[model samples]
Target: MTERRMVAAIDTSLVATAAAAFSVLCASTSFAGVLADSRWVFPALLVVVVVAALGVLGRRLHWPLYATASTQVAGVLVVLSSQFAEHAVLGLLPGPAAISELGELLSGAADVVRTGVPPVPAEPALQALVCLGLGLVAIVVDLVVVGLRSPAVSGLLLLCVFAIPASLSDTMLPWWTFVAGGVGFAVLLASGGQHRRWRRHEDREQVTRALFGPTSTAVAGTAGVIALLTGVVFTGVGTEGRLPGSVPEQFGGTDGIGLQPFTSLRGQLNRDKEVELFRVRGLKEPTYLRALTLRKFDPERGWELEGLTQGVEANAQLPLPEGTDIGEGDAQRVEIQPIGYRDPWLPVFGVPRFLSGMGVNWRYDPASGIVFTQTNQESRPYVQQLVVPKPTPEQLRDARGPMRVAPEYLDTTGIPPQVTDLAQRLTADAGTEFDKAVALNRYFTDPSNGFRYDLQTAPAGGGDALSEFLFRGKRGFCEQYASSMAALLRAVGIPSRVAIGFTAGYRQGDERVITTEDAHAWVEAYFPGWGWQTFDPTPLSDGRSALPQYLNSELHPAQQPSSAPDPAQPSTPPTDGSTPGGGPQDDQGARPAPVDPRETEQSNPWPIAIGVLVLALALLAAPAVVREVRRRQRVRAISGGAAGSAGLAWQEVLDEFRDRGAQPAATDTARQVATKLLEHHALDESGAKAMRALVVAVEREWYSANGRSDESLPETLRTVLDSLRRASPLDLRSRAFPRSVLQLLRPQP
Candidate 1:
């Protein structure tokens, strides 16, 4: 009966332990997820994790979980832990962000790492990775704690349960399961209680089997369904979503419809804006701008810019196939930087000689000349390339296309006609297309004429964006310049369009991998014979946007560094004649003399003496401290009389010696273990005076008592140790003659 009760107690303890561990896991996971979601909440997340760790330990001791419903809730808590992890977190942890949002984080990391891994970008994805790892360990412990309660198979089942989440985040599990399960089963064979448990656990076996019976059919069916759905979604979303998490929910609409933000997580996630991704293919990447369809602007039902869809039919405008959309022209590649496409209506570089990318399923509008994708903001990371036509300046100068004037163009295009008139006036004086391009380019670049380009960082004027740019603001970013220029050119009876893309950025040794900071926008004008001519109007005035360096860097994850973003910059032009991102301009002819080495050294005493002192202390003190610590540990390990030995007192003595600098290296074999003393380890010239007492005690023990001073062993040991230390390695080496005479004396004795 007692044996049966003990067995029952063990079984109960195991269940309780597993449940308790699960509770800790859930609580910790939920809090961690929260921190991972919002980096600022990390401290709170850490605290919860520590608390949960304590609970995990307590659970391993078999704390019961049948206490309340709160216990069950604890298991679920883990699902929500780790919130708002930064992109840099990925690099720091073995585990990655969940499959849902990791695409952008990791790919961004991969890109950052690619550009000379040495000066790495400081991204937050690495921290998120650590959280991922910790969460997994906690989950595993919870399972193993339970499994150990019964047979080893129980451990496997527990592992499978915990694995569900790990697999959800990092899906390389089938292999891990095979390896881990194999090793575990191998060990199960060695357990001695299995035979007895198998005979006695008939009831438990039945219960376990019933709860987790064969679901091969269900598993097979799930695989089939997943495969079919995956195929359909793939066909619908396009190649842009090759990486998981690449597709945002906003991009998954049908043939006529398109992708939009995932409304299901409205409160859980904030999809403030769609990320702008650019791709260049062919001649050069003409900037690809997302055409905003503006029909019903409700200020509340999201922006109504232009061409958005409402369904899913796996359809978007495919690129103009090899022989479509063009009559021969120079080979070229059009680059696109898709800003948030407010509506489905897409903007392009005049004639999109070819089109294929995310949201490319919309029907082309011949009247307005817009080709919108059938998807919304959350569908995918969009990047498309095309062989866009580039016309020569000579061709564009003599070309005039049929003009159509619609006052309603103001409403449909949502732009004022005055903006277009400006373009015409700007180009009126030019004789050739090239001349016009040169004139516009020169007007913007002239140093005397102070127009500048910068991404607006300050608070904006209330109301319409158009008014804000024309009257209230003197400086505009690349998009603003491109838009105004296009409007101006179009008004001059010229078929022109605004395009968005990255401008040429710093290119090293040849890989040509573009960075997020390179995101840019420009303009393209249609010409009669040659094709479309590209023109840049944004004055490269010196003012860098105060974006954190990483946000604009190709090196690290998008982590904001402390030095970035000049927050104190005022909006008005500086009296100093320098631009915002450019800093206070300096005279070009300044130079300075080189510094003297002696003066440089004089300024830094801490770096010289202090650094040396610290290093010396570490090297000289470590071995002694380690040895004493080891000796103390041994004292603690032994019992009774051995424990009462002078080991503890000697440890204290060693510590004092170290404090006074009598440190010995572990590799230093014992030699004149004595004179290391007189020259060093002693209390001044009292060294020999002090040495007399110790030598006499050792002599008596050695000669008269046969090396045994049982009653005074501790005192004798301490004295001999002190003398040995006095012998000093330096003194011993120099005093070899005395050592030879001492050897003769020993023989006589």
Candidate 2:
């Protein structure tokens, strides 16, 4: 009868501990904002109910451990069905529609993980995924901690749950959350050990004594101290400056769906490594290779590529440029041999009239005149028949105004006041829109204006970026020049947009090798009658001198006075002092400056030093702190009551003997432990008598129906504890930092 009752008590304790551990695991989901509002309440409550029910059912039915796992899996499916069933086929189970929705939700979550920097805002799809993941983690933790009875392994699993968000993004979790979870797992381990000890005994009195014994309390106390100290150390070593935070530009590529192209342009321009992107042949002159045009300009959000028209057949011809006549264009055939380049947008020198040797998966957008592939495709050698128009300045100057163009192409909604004023002031001397554009272009390209081209300057501010660039700092790269020029044209009522692509690469033998460093940005002004005309506002002196002769001729005389002698253009000087078209060249291209490592280290060393010192000190003092705390807890239990006082005293004596290397076996009774300690150590007569007396008190407390209480029992135990410490071989270590406390706290299998 007593054995059955003890087993029942052990089962009850395991069930309670499992429930608490599950609750703690669920609570950790709040750190990722999964429970920011009431939306998580239903799922969290369901998890609690399922975990509690499974624990109790498994204990009462004496079912195998596999039964618990099966029930938890069923609970997850039911919960998912109930939450998402409205979108399913039958409205009662997860059908095709529900599965598709789940796939889309997971895909969106993946995108967020790929692109977004946390703290990620809560969306329905992300919230659902987080809740599902949290539920699964909680079930695993419960199985590991309760079913397997390995709290240390469960703690490691819980640590993984906390590490996911921390590793994915740079956001730091709260210290209190770690402490709460750690405490819950520690309590589960302590309860598991106590349960196991109870199962070892058949007498109800022995089981009760084991439940509140010094070993159980010491385990609980030591685990609590270690967990709390760990939390403190983690908090002290804050996560700031430890993580590599996300930069949107670093991941940008050919799709134009992310901020990569816009944001990464600066780094690409500043990179010293020369990586060849592609190569071109059969070109009579160097011209900019147009890739994609950004038309949707929100002053606050910067430039954006709105849409792509996909799935046009390979044989389809591209539409003519908006306001140009194809009959008056010059045709040219160029062979493009791709080096290592792979972008969604194909590079072309002019408007493509015909394409050959390209894959069938390629598509074209007639409006933007860009050819793209649906999926990321490897770059291949292709031939293109392009219509390169040589429109005269007289024709462009006679083209119609903005009234004849599409309204979408002429939007100037968010231009700042300063930008408008500057545009008006710059074009004050010009009458026609073409002349006004020429004037603005002249303003940026003219060297006398003191506009120095630099790639390392700070980025322009949002909405007022043009204003800041033009009126304040005048140093920037091609992106600032192209974007600001586009905004200026829009402000003065000209339809224009920014185009990004590679410039004319250096000529090696007959092939032009285009590298990442040749990536450039320029504006295309829309001429109502003549179509979109390319305008290079970036200065010719800044590694970009290969402009079309027609545009170059128009700006040459207008920029320099006829009375003053023209200064030689500052070009990227080549090793031989000349390039194609008599342009200045650079030696092995312009190499960016090497990065300095000491700059980061020298910025703030004091804070790092202090943090390291504090962490080291805390770690060094942890063992002593835990030992002191366990000693205080044992003292309190001895002074509390007579029913458990003798048991507590006897356990303390055993811990001292165990710490000094005279460990008692699990089946050892109080008298056996006393005899072992006496034989191991050379104790005086008084010490031996005190040890025997403490053993007698413990045995009497265990067997007697009405426990005897004595006021002097606490005093007698203190005397016995001191005598054992003096007789032990490992005296100093036992008195200072007791290893037995750590042994009890170790998770029991």
TM-score of 2: 0.53
Give the lowest summed-lDDT range of ten residues in model 2.
Answer: 1-10
Off by over 4 Å in 2: 1-287, 306-316, 326-344, 373-382, 387-405, 431-435, 442-469, 472-479, 503-520, 528-530, 536-749
- Put down candidate 2 lDDT per residue, 1-749, tens digits, no spaces: 11101011123344444545454554465354212234344454455456655665665476777887777766665556555434765554667767767676776565555444334334445556665776677677666666666656666766666555545533335545555555565555555544454432133344444445776566555655665565455434422212223222122223445433454454344332355677777765667888877876777657767544453554556666555553356688899988756555677877777777766677766556567765434658888888777777777778764454446567887888888898999999998888888899988866566554655334435436667778777767777788889989998989888887877776766666777667788888877666777887876443445565446666875543321112232123233212111111235534333222223323666634654575567656666665554455556656776346676566566666667766666555566767877888867777888877776776666676786865667777777777765766565556455676556422110
- Report the number of clashing residue pairs per model: 119, 6
lDDT per residue for candidate 1 within 87-141, as digits (tens), equals: 2243222134434344444444343222211111122443344344444444444
